[model samples]
Target chain A: MLNRIRCLLIKELTQIRRDPRLFGILIMAPIIQLVVMGFATNTDIREIALAIRDNDRSFHSREYIRALAASGYFRVAALPGPVAGDARQLVAGRAGLVLVIPPGFGRQLVRRAPATVQALVDGADSNFGMQGVNYLNQATRLFSARFAREVAVDARLRGLALPAVAAETRVWYNPELTSRYYMVPALMGVLLLVTTMLVSSMALVKEREEGTMEQLIVTPLRPMEIILGKLLPFVVIGFAEVTLALPLMRLIFGVPLRGSVLLLYALSGVFLLTTLGLGLFVSTLVRTQQQAMLIAAFFVMMPFILLSGFIFPVENMPPAFQVVAQFIPLKYYLTIIRGIFLKGVGWHALWRDGLILLAWGVGILSLAALKFHKRLD
Target chain B: MLARAGLAPALPLVTPAPRVWFNPELESARFLVPGLIGMLLMISSVVATALSIVREKERETIEQLMVSPLRSEELVLGKTLPYLLIGLATMALILLLGWQLFGVVVRGSWLLLGLATVLFLFAGLGLGVLISALTRSQQVAFQVAIIASLLPAIILSGLIFPIRNMPLPIQGLSLLVAPRYFIEILRGVILKDTAFVELWPNFAALLALGAAYNLLAAHKMKQGL
Candidate 1:
């Protein structure tokens, strides 16, 4: 059985190589996607374009604007003249935020009275809008503290900057919060899924579509041997992609690999079992390559990409969405990949993820192996 | 908490009163519907066309076609035109559904939307043809088609994630993605009521990409035949 499986693997490899176009695409698509996603999957939303409508035209109004700008979270994109507070800037997609200062704004501040400024936010991207608000509040607090000291006498005596309790955020493990560092590692799991699942499924369906699958079934090979033979090439291909992507992600994106390289590769081997199993399972369900591609793209790829915490964190997802995300094998693998790459944690810290992944790999592979075997009989 | 700290006289400096524009309620459906329209059009047209030629190759029907009286251009045109029409029909149905279900009104110029849709579909068909010419299998064609349409549309395009937030190089790379232009046009027309002047560049970009892909597909088909 091992000998037949090895022969089948060789044949599969030769056929894959014969089509240079397909081979090149299979090898390169994942790396290209990883690079693109690495650059694009930035959750750290900085440099929000803000349009300031200064009606008071006072030093204090300018001070508030200056404070907001100084926060490094917002960029002063435009200074529209105060009129009707028309959010054309926000509407035009030029700015995500608009700060409107009323006429009594500076006067209220001089008297140490509470003054209000209207912040017209493009709430279209609601999460981004919320972040902008959070940043706005933080900047206001910092500015209010200084203003309270100079403008309002007896700072602590009168309720001012001191909120009694404050939340100080000290970022640990990838403190720079370089989104690329976090995203690049997670991309390993994502790219692996796309390449392995699609290629293995398509390759299997192609054989069946071309009538070669029946030829294999007639041979001395066992059902398990044929299934293993069909999928093992994708296992090699998956690892090849991860290996290619990792060094590039490290050197170019500067995603430091602090964890053991051997551990990363070992865990990746475990990850492939699940992906390859999924690929095999998808192949068994579809007759045509069209059906296989559709199912793999929609059923397998879509959920993994969206909810696997590849771009959006699983924690941030709605509770219902989070529950759905939990079932994706990639989610656990993603945590392992990121933790190993960024935090340099070993299985001691990541045993839960490793066990989950191992369980997923074995469970999925066995079920798929059995299903493929039954289909032949 | 400020009072509890015993820090009296909490001086409020410029409280922010929030205002929203367009779909002021910030309905995600309004944003998502336009993007979904572009994505559906992309998948249907591009995948339809992408699979058109490759299936023949896989099934060994190309030799029969080559022997027939039909020229390669006619075969390409005949294969792709139905998809274009179907894509438009799908777009209209989705638009009507969006309007009825989500109250996603077309606030911009209809002429521009119609014009943009045709050009976008043309570009998609051209891409599908190009992908068909490139690959030898239905699976490969579908994979290439998805990468071409969906991934870029979701990530590179300002559909879910704002494109402005991407790094500079990726933002530059986004200029090459055809769906980005289409989605930009969709949001411009559906939500912003943006004038043709503002959206002219997006239109121009779509046309250029469409023309480029068509020319490339023509060259590839000639070679393929």
Candidate 2:
């Protein structure tokens, strides 16, 4: 049985050795893809258009005006002349953000009366517009805090009334709030799912097309043995790929892994099993390589990317999509990788993820095994 | 119908074209270079290798090849090298075009990129061989190759979505996919100007993956022996 497996493995290697183009793809595609992606995917959004309607010509209002301009998140495309009606034109023109400082001369501040500043934000592109609103709000809040401090100090230096309680705002996960830190880790999950499904599914289809599968079927080797022999090479290869990927990210992209390496690999094992099983199952269903490739690509790649919380948070996804995302092995795997790499959480925190992966692995493997048997029948 | 007085064709109305918006220097990368590399690799490994093996089985050429003095290694290399070299040449052509047409800079060290490419080639070749081992037909091999190529290179390598924000389990899964490492090395060398010390672990992983995969291929290639 061992010799049979070895013989099959050797035959496979010989075919690869003879194919130069495949060898090149394994080597060159990554570099080309990276170059294209690095240039195309930029998180830092620049050159936003903003319209401002200033109702008061007071020094305070002017100061606020200056603050908005200095924030660099917006470009003052137009300034309305006294009327809110003129401001409406800019918004209609699809200006991304609008600032309207209401008419309240310096008298309101002197009397300690409240003042309101209105900001109309565009939510057309949710990701971009939402981030813009957050930035605008932060800038406005800082300006208010500084102004309050100055007023209190001038009113009374030593005996200034201290607030009863101060609220401290702390952002979780990403403190600097750089998008890449969050994005790069999430991308890893997407990439893993892609490679696994593509490799495993295609492997089976290729075998069936080649007629070597017929020979193998006629041979003494069992279907289970054939599947294992096929799966082991990819699993071993995939593991090596991930090991290489980690430090490259650390050194080049500055992504840090704060968790135990062993734990990460262990979890990956379960995840790979699931993906490998999925690919094998796909292979069994389709007779032609092209059909298998298309099926795997469409069914696996698109949904896995959109719903796996790779780009948008699963929490933020519509409940229906969220429920559907649960079935994607990547959804579970993404949480595990991020938790280990960033939060450094172990089994105490990650057992759920591990269980899901194990369940997926077992489920997919059984399905694949059954499918293999069906093909024989 | 034209002879009838009422049959004169109405003159076509002239319409103005839609007003164009300002296009702000949107630099787009022509994916042909990478696309070609991916396409050729997929074809050679999954399509070509599978077809050849299937044909051999159908024609009873397998018996002749097995009995020949050529070792399994020689047979595999002989069969696989043509495709491998073609893939490499295609890669070089695409790289040249990418630079000339798109101004895509190769920021990483050339030596490191070359070494990483070699390792990645080994892995791809190994994977193709492994796929060939498991199947009896070209269709099965091609399907497997597509599955392997699509995911790891496209998503897991930080090519499309940033890897950082991915929930934890997916990240763990990516660690095992080889293309993720190759993409790292490629990106590290080309975009980040990464050094060898930084690229070594990825290279090591590729080497290990390639070695292990090839070993399995070697074992499977001599199946009847």
Candidate 3:
């Protein structure tokens, strides 16, 4: 049985090696896809366009506008007109935020009286509007503090303490809140699914389409042996992709590998079984490679990426989606990957997700094997 | 089309609330349909055209066509034209459905929308032809089609991720991607009621990319790839 499987593996590898273009694309496509998309997924919304109508046009108002721009979150554009209050920028979609600073302006600030600045946000983009509000709020508080200090100094007063609740936040794991730090590791798991499941699903379909499936079925090898033979090479490819992607991710994107490499490989081995098995199941359902590609992509791959907590937080997903996500092997693998890469925790922290992934591997691999055997018969 | 598109951005309205315009209820469909159109165009144009051409090669029908009186350019046109028309038909259906089912209507000019969709179809079909020319099997074409067109279009096109928020370097690179302009035009027309004057640059870029890609595909077809 082992010998028969080895022959099949060698035959498959030889075919892949012969088609260098496909092999080259197969090797590089997923990594390049991962890197390009992963790098672009900076969820931190920065550089939100702001159209500010500075009513005061005072030194302090200009200083305040400069501070907002310097924070690197908002791009400030000054409107020459008075506080028209109509928010033309928002109406036109040119800017996500609009600010109208009242003329009561510098005098109120010099006396430490209440200073009022009106803000108008475009609600058309919910996420952008929310983030812009948050950043603007923080920037204003900082600017106000600085202005208050200068006023106290000019008056020759020793101390002016404004009572407030200041949040001194210390973020752990990903210190800078860079979305790349969050997405790159999650993308590693997504890459495994794209490379392995789609490749394996298409493998048998390609054979059937080429009229070689019957030839393979007529061979002396058992169906289980053939299944392992087909899936095992991709298992190797999946590992090689991860192995290659790891250092490249580190070098290019500065994605840290905090956990033990050995441990990651161990968990990855378990995850591949689930993906390969899912691919085998997909292969049994398709006639042509095109059908295989579409089904695998739309049905399997899309749902996996969505539910895997890669982009939208799985916790934020509705209860129904959360329930459906429980069955997805990629979901478990993601927790393991993100935990290992970002949190640097070991078996104690990750054992539950690891265990669930292993069970999924065994469950799905058996189910796929049964289906493949039935198809062969 | 050009005059209407050029004249539209000249007028501006004052919103009662800065956050919500046009969409008072904030129906997710209003935000989603434009991106959906962009994604569907990619799948149908790139995947459908590439698959159709590669299927002919796989089934050995291309040899029959090549031996016939048709020139390679005509063959390319014959092959891609149906898909382009079909893509437009599909876009129209989607617009109808979007309005009927989701109440997400196209506020921009229909002529401008049609032109953008046609230009985008050419760009997508060119990519399909290029992939078909490169690969011998449907499997390879399918993989390459997704990687080269669909993935980049979805990610780099500001369909899901806003292009304005991207780092300037990535934003610069995104200019090479055709769907960026298509989706931008779609959103401007569909959601924000943006006029053609505001969107002429995007339309120009789409036309250039479409011509470049189709011309390159023609060159490859003549070379017998």
User: Which candidate tops lDDT?
Assistant: 1
Candidate No. with top DockQ: 1
Top model by TM-score, which number?
A: 3
TM-score of only chain B in every candidate structure: 0.87, 0.75, 0.83
lDDT of 3 by residue, B38-113 (tens): 8778766887667766787888887787788877777777778888889999999988998897788788788989
DockQ of each: 0.42, 0.02, 0.14
* TM-score of candidate 1 against the unseen true structure: 0.84
Which 10-residue span in candidate 2 chain A carries the lowest summed lDDT?
A31-40
* Candidate 3 steric clashes: 5
The TM-score measured for candidate 3 stands at 0.85
Writing each residue's lDDT as its tens digit, candidate 3 over A1-377 gives 88898899999999888877777777889888777777677766778998888778787778888988898888888876545635556656777888777786766665556676777776555566667777788787777667644544544453333233446555465523457887788887887787788678887778888899899989998877888898888888889889988987898889888898888999999999889888888888878777777777777876777667766788987899899999888988988998899789898898898899889888877777787778787
The positional error of residue A250 in candidate 2, measured at the CA in angstroms, is: 1.5
Q: Arrange candidates by TM-score, highest first: which order?
A: 3, 1, 2
**Candidate 2 C-alpha lDDT tens digits along A15-82:** 65666454344334433333233322335555466677777778877776677678776777547465
The regions of model 3 sitting more than 4 angstroms off are A80-88, A102-115, A150-177, B1-33, B85-115, B164-169
- RMSD from true fold, candidate 2: 18.5
Tens digit of lDDT per residue, candidate 1, span A1-377? 67888899899888888877777888898788878877786666778888888888888888888888898888885475545645567666777888778898888888878887788887666657777777777787788767765644555445454433435666575523576688778877877887788777776678888999888888998877887888777778888987898889877788889898888888899899888888888888888887877677768887788789887779977799899998999998999999989899997988888888889988887887788788788
Of the two candidates 2 and 3, the one with more favorable TM-score, higher being better, is 3
